[model samples]
Structure formats: C-alpha cells, structure tokens
Target: MNAITQINPGIRQQILDAFNFRHATKIFDPDRKISDEDFNVILEAARLSPTSFGHEPFRILMIQSPEKRELFREFSWGANGMMNGSSGQLGTASHFGIILAATDELMRAGSDYLQDHYARVKQLPDEVIEIFNGAYGKFQAEDHKITSGREITDWSGKQAYIVLANMMTAGALMGIDSCPIEGFDMARTTQVLAEDFGIDTAKWKPAVMFAFGHRAKDPEFLKTRRTMQDTVSWF
Candidate 1:
C-alpha cells in the first residue's frame, strides 16, 4: 500500500485555504519566477498523484530558455488572451512552461511490469508467455481507433491530467501562479520539438502544457462553484 505522511492539522488547513484561494491567473510578472526548489516541490506533488494500475504514465518537459519560451508562446493560442487581457498588466510567465507527454514505450513498459508482478501469482502457469502474448495481442486488437501502443498512451494522458491538477493546486498553495493550457498548435509544436531534438515522431505525443510563474497581482476568481448540496444526493 502506498503510505502518505501525516500532515499537521494547521498545515492541512493552510493547504485547503490555498486551494480555495487559487484561480486561473491570466498574467504573471515577467520579472518574477518560482524558485527552483519550489518548482520541484510542485512537480513532486504531480509525482505523488495516483495513477491507474500503478502505471505512472507521463513525462514532464520543463522548458525555460527565453528563445524557446518565445517560440512556444507563438504556438500557444491561449497566449493571445494573456498578452492582451488582465494578465498582461501583471506580465507573463517568468518561469518556464511545462509540457506533459505519454510515449508508446511507457505503455509497453507498464504491460511488462504487470506481467512480471502477476508471474508468481497462484493458479498462474509457470510457463505461459505464449498464452500471455496471444491474449495481449487480442487486447491490442480490441482498440479500434488507434494501435494498442497508442491506446496505452491514451490511458496515460488521463493520468497526466491528475498530475496537472495536483501541480496547479500545489503551486497555488506555494504562492505560485499557473495557467492550465490546452490551446496550442500541438502538431506544429511537436514537429518543431521532434525535429530539433531528433525525437521519434511516432512514439511520443504531446498532451498539454502548463504556464507557471509568480503572480504579478492577485487573481480575481469571479467564477461560480457548485456546492455539495447541488452535486450530492443519497440515492
């Protein structure tokens, strides 16, 4: 079983208070950035997020170079809003942007882990690699829209969202600002990165990117939230 550390009651309240205080910051102060240690703490929160079947399926790409940030900004469709809106007054990301991805390798790797763990189970055949391979092939074939490898990546993408949320909440609690982004020229960005780094275009897929920095001003969280009374009902 996964063990969680006992947090102080006071600290837990602070964390909850932080969550309630966070909002989608439109702009960040360009002169301000999150400290390296603090950024790592935010990443650690993402790492601690639960995953399906214990397959922690995502790689985080922390991009920080000014040139790269500019290049990335060009493709981020959401940036136009940030550049011209309330966030503009505060400035834009001083810290690097984070890109999340899932690769074909991670899925195959997860399958291997599952097979290895199941090998010593009771009622399991001592030599059933062939049977297992066949079953795996069938399982792979069941995916209609994409290859089995791609399916694994799809599964990983969902897990990545859990990490995104954790990081956003964690960063906010640490007094960092974040913009969860899904609007980008993904294919173009992927092409640029893959060609530049010689990454296999077929294997890794871009999921989403996050913009992080210190908030230049307080975020106005004017959005409405649903209450427990509206959402929960005992059937």
Candidate 2:
C-alpha cells in the first residue's frame, strides 16, 4: 500500500454533508430500486462495524419479500403509514432489515459460544482465552452488574446499534435514504419471527429494524440541532 501524506481539504465537509443529507425518510419511491452492488456495500459496512469484545453477537435479517413486509404491517406501527397517507417505509422501501442481538446464553463470560469464538474466530491461544474470559467475567459480574438474562441481552443489543449506525451512514454517503425504526411490539414481533421466519428466539432477539430506499420526496423541515457549544464539553 502507498503511504498517505496530506489530508484532502474538503474531506470533513463532505462527511458532514452526508450527515445533513440523511433523514428519517418515512416514505420511499416504490418504483425506485437500490442496486444490488450499492446495497451490498451497505451490508459490508455493517459487517465491518466494531462490537464489544469483537464478539459480533448480532445477526441481520433482510426482509425483502412482499409477503413478509405485509405481515409486518400488523405489528410495526412505525412503518405502516405516512402522515400524508402515502405508503410508509415497509410498503415502499427497497430493503428492510431486522438486527437480532444474541441472547444471554451465548454472551455470558464462559459460555460455549464465547469459548469457540475466542479459539476460532479471534484466533486466540488457550492461555490467552483463559485470561480474557477472567477479565470479561469480572466486567459482567461487578463492573456492569449484568446478572439477569435481560440485562445481558440489553448489553448485546447496544452493540447492534453501532452496526446499525454504520449501515445508515454508508447508505447516506451513497445518496440512499433510510429510516431507523423501533415502533413495533417486541413480543409480537418476536413471535412473528419464530413462527414465520424460522428464527430461534432462544438464541437471538431482535434489537432494531431499518428501511432503505430512495425518498419519495424531500422532507419539509430542515434538520435542526443544538449548537456545538451547548452539546459538547472539552475536558
């Protein structure tokens, strides 16, 4: 690889521009489709995102079948309709995704899943794995006090959001629109996944969902935020 020397002048502005261009697009142009190439890039961005301990204890389910999307209408209040009566993200977006975080059984300090992950995926030696697991056990038991199954799952779920953010930003940089959704009944959605999608709820639970496509129209309001001085602090 060639060594890099100087930074591009407008690189920072370009990144900020992508953030400004992105919005919670509620409606998408059904007629427009995201190319397989571009969508794969978004998925790759998600694949490369960092997770706590490199565990990557999350999986993404892409919902593309019309039948599946139609089924979501019954549970996903956030994606069922637009305020203006147009079809919402589920009905019109070119792609939809459900991010599933691994359950507590797979994430506990010395669980079988973590053991295999350390030895195989992370390529760590047996001695190193033992040391790492000891530190992780303490982190869970004392530092974070993650005792209950619910607490463990919630911790894993937070890592899924990191991947979700990367995928959305990648799409925005490519001029694709996206919306992050959390407006579904968790119990109902979980039941639906188990019954219709053949997902094992015992091992994985849905953390969040998203929709992606070309926006049907521009948002009416400009993006707003607090001033940088008000939002950040220098130590």
C-alpha lDDT score of every prediction, in listed order: 0.67, 0.93
TM-score of 1: 0.73
State the lDDT at 69 in candidate 1: 59
How do the residues 150-216 of candidate 1 rate in per-residue lDDT, one tens digit apiece? 6767767888888899999988888787877777787887887787656565656777777788766
Q: Tell me each candidate's TM-score.
A: 0.73, 0.95
TM-score of 2: 0.95
Candidate of highest lDDT = 2
Model 1, residue 47: distance off in Å is: 2.3
